[model samples]
Target: MAWYYVENNESVGPVQESDLHALSQQGKITAQTMVCRQGDTAWVPFAQAFAPGSAAVAVADPAGAPRVSHSCVMCQKSVTADDAVQLSGNWVCATCKPLYLQKLKEGATISGVRRYAGFWIRVGAKIIDSLILMMVTIPFQFIATALIPGANDPKAIGAVIALAVVTNGFNILSNLAYQVFFLGKYAATPGKMVCKIKVIRSNGAAVTYGRATGRYFAEILSGLTLGIGYLMVAFDEEKRGLHDRICDTRVIYKD
Candidate 1:
């Protein structure tokens, strides 16, 4: 029987069983290393694949049938061939197929696995960001109010309107700057950093300044949708919000 193992995130060649054991003894292969037999469509931990009486190995059934189990690449769960779908040479179980297809549609690099941030956690991060922005904008609000003339003075109406416009414009620019700076440079805002989540391109590349700015503006659509866009994260297979979908971005946990 021939076996393969994952090394440095790449699948290594098919070796004989004795060679696999030798590699294990040399510390080149560990129990947690993913391995699969040549005929198997699923990859499993080395320990599970070779453990005594492990079900991962094919066995002869009393009914003269072969019972072979495969592992889902997305969830790492054992499943029969009939229960899994092969995509891009990887086996994904039915439960993970929808999400996998979504990733594929978005051109996301589906290597190994990913843990996406859920709705409540994202909401918490948004709350933190809102509080921080409030702290920043409140002082500006006070200054703007003080600069405006009394409402009773009809002559000052034009000045008040001008002041209001300038203040609002400044607020918008500042907010845009904040988002663009953090997301472009670090791939996360302070709130997302606190939550241990980061935004990245669907292709698993780093976010650029232009993409970050566009994403900041795209959030307006999310807000305009009466928050249905935000709520989509709860039901989305990859936990993507409307802005994420529009910008082809994904929020995932840090390694």
Candidate 2:
């Protein structure tokens, strides 16, 4: 008996040869019916291919219309109807699609539950680190003012330039160094280390620099509006900090 494999709105003939005969004998298929074979990329039938619940077809649509949806690639969340968010060539649920893409753009790993440092501790450490950075920056700012000639003119441009050269750079560097060195080595920042907390990737891996930046920026968004955003963490399923959802990151327990 000749067999056919159903694939991509089309049918190709002579699949496994034996599989078709077996299906035919079992009454699971008929000459005018459509079915699929094992080890085949898709389902095919004597007439057309049918996905999981579309079996008892009453009409000969012949087009093998795809009325159902596939699961999401990242969260594996199912999407049934047409209104679902389609991302990365798969059907992703509404709540997860935006989040998943946010992380992907930032290159976050986003795998499983992870440990995170307490909010207060992180805030405090950033303060101390920023202070130290300021100390290092003031001297450099004076040097820059003398070197740039117009750097002292407080017209916003020069001031902004001076700030970027001195304070802003140092501040950013300080935070980067603090998070990367601490989190990479101990899975915690100085504050997190002191607070006995740590940040972890969703998959139990050490948080990477890229993901850390995403989460940190998300923190900025969460804090820009009177801290109402941070409160969203308490309501989240994984207890995500504002940064977690945006970064596709999470904080979990070390022990």
Candidate 3:
């Protein structure tokens, strides 16, 4: 039984078998610990017994100089240290957090960092979709408030109520139907399809309902600024519209 520190991927161990078991049960040691006994070529977990002083080794260097340790996950992206992210054992630069997160959300394990959707494409898509929703709703509103007068009239109120209910329900139906069936199933809407674009997970996995819901609500943010925020996609690095970023989605080539 013993204890070891697994920093930077190297293990220093062989404390005491009883101590190791106690640490394991106390949650100090994990199954991933690489403990090994003296004269053993292979490493085992903390649960195994090992000779004291067996884990320490002379970390060799090319020039016998102090090694400038490089990050296990990537370059100088010290995420957990400087930033308050505290994501995991690895570190990442602030600029790379979103990119790394997107890959993670999509079920991809990327070492270091990789780019995902940028601010523009995510925002812009949201703006456009919200506008489309508004366009769809305007007619319904007009018909409910203006065209149908005396909405409070008992005799005709029922009809007006029915119309309003149907109209209100349409937005929800459209959102669910279009997103689940068209976006999820076909990967695009009429406009997106026509533009030869498709929405996909950053890791290229199938879209899920939760992600689609995020995209759906993100439309409101884009609409908040009359779609100016959405139009910002034209200048974004990833060409992401607002909604795309909000949903952690990307619009890419259809093919």
Alpha-carbon runs more than 4 Å astray in model 2? 1-118, 121-125, 128-135, 138-166, 234-237
Off by over 4 Å in 1: 1-112, 151-156
- Winning candidate number (TM-score): 1
Worst 10 residues of 2 by lDDT: 35-44
Model 2 scores what on Cα lDDT? 0.58
- Write the candidate numbers in order of decreasing TM-score: 1, 2, 3
Q: Where's the lowest-lDDT run of ten residues in candidate 1? A: 58-67
When 1 and 3 are scored with TM-score, the better candidate is: 1
Which predicted model would earn the best lDDT? 1
In angstroms, give how far residue 177 of model 3 lies from its true place: 1.7
Q: Could you estimate the TM-score for every candidate?
A: 0.56, 0.44, 0.42
lDDT of 3: 0.57
Model 1 TM-score, all chains together: 0.56
